[model samples]
Target: MLATIERVLILDRAEEISKMVLQSEIAEEYFRCIYKVKNNLETQRKIREFIKVKEQYEEVQRFGKYHPDYRVVMIKVRELKREMDLDEHVAKFRIAENELQSLLDEISVIIGHSVSEQIKVPTGNPFFDSSSNCGGGCGSGGSCGCSA
Candidate 1:
């Protein structure tokens, strides 16, 4: 019962901190960019067109060598993809989204590190370590089996 109450208090505090973070300048900018892109009719139309073309191309591919229009569909798909990538609004939105995602990823990593520390879990660059014998079975010439 006490543990449950403590957990609820911690969660409440965490939610409060999250609300504060969302009101910060960086979060505000992220939301602004996201809303701007979402509200753009032209951008939305282009995105829909691109998705339709991509789906058509995928369907053709799924038919394998049996589909006669596979080559033409692939060409159309590539063209549509290129045009979509060239769109200014779409490009800007992608950049903004990437930035926001990176920020979120960094925050998640920080929180993960904090939790790991409290739990006494080993945390650091999991990629390469000369001291630790827990060679991640990465099969890249190292004891870890992880492939390069």
Candidate 2:
């Protein structure tokens, strides 16, 4: 399985590669952490795929029993276990937790950085203004206030 390299800095054109690459450095540690995670997933997927590729690998030993990607991926896996003091296959779970938070943070930052007000008008009825509906769900046929 091919590893998906997430683009940290959104780019529009070819000229933006410099900016993307530059901003990528600001999140160097972030990207490094993400890469380790993505590579780990790829490694696990490859392990499953290896059952199919095993014959090809055997016939063509240019990459040997262990592909170069396997070593880097395995090293990251080992590093994660040692760093987190995790046992056996539990590191994958921990990495998912960390990566999920990192992903959420990155997305929040992106959204916060480029925020725009969305105008949601109630269809073509301009008279029925949402701003005027201040009674919460009461305006939508749901109870918001209690009977005294």
Candidate 3:
């Protein structure tokens, strides 16, 4: 019973700390950027189009390299992605998201290392290698093979 109470207290304190971090100036800016993109009709339309094109690209890929339309589909997908990246709102949102992710990753690494040390495990390469490996559900389409 006492252990359960202690666990609840720890969880409550962790949630409080998380709330504090979210209320920080940088976090506020991140949220503002995300909200701006989310609320913009134009951005939403472009994102929808981008998702459609990405899905088409994936479908083409499943046809394998021998498919006659594979090359054409690939080219089209690249062009669509380029146009999406050029959108001011999308680009800004991506930048803000990356910044927020970096902060979270740093926090995760610190905690991971601390836990690893406590368990007598080596803390080499704290985070999983995100390069050349599909971290899964990348949402970027398979254009970047990291999610492949």
Give TM per candidate: 0.69, 0.22, 0.68
- lDDT for 28 in candidate 1 is 80
Candidate 3's C-alpha lDDT? Answer: 0.70
lDDT of candidate 2 over 1-148, digit per residue (tens): 5444433324344346445544653445455554665557655554444444444444445665467555554555555434444432335545654554454444444443355323222322233323323221244443433221
Worst 10 residues of 3 by lDDT: 117-126
lDDT, candidate 1, 1-148, per-residue tens? 4679879997998898788768876678777767866788877777788899888888988897689988888888888788877877778767766666555655555664577522211333343232234332335574453332
| Weakest ten-residue segment in model 1 by summed lDDT | 119-128
Please give the lDDT score for candidate 1: 0.67
- Sorting all predicted structures by TM-score, with the top scorer first, yields 1, 3, 2
- Estimate candidate 3's RMSD in Å: 9.3
Runs of candidate 1 exceeding 4 Å displacement: 1-5, 117-148
The total number of steric clashes, by the backbone 3 Å criterion, in model 2 comes to 0
Query: What C-alpha lDDT values do all the predictions have?
Result: 0.67, 0.44, 0.70
In angstroms, the error of model 2 at 142 is: 46
Per-candidate Cα RMSD to the true structure, in Å, reads 5.4, 17.2, 9.3
Better of 2 and 3 by TM-score: 3
Please list the residue runs of candidate 3 whose C-alpha ends up more than 4 Å from where it truly belongs after superposition: 1-5, 113-148
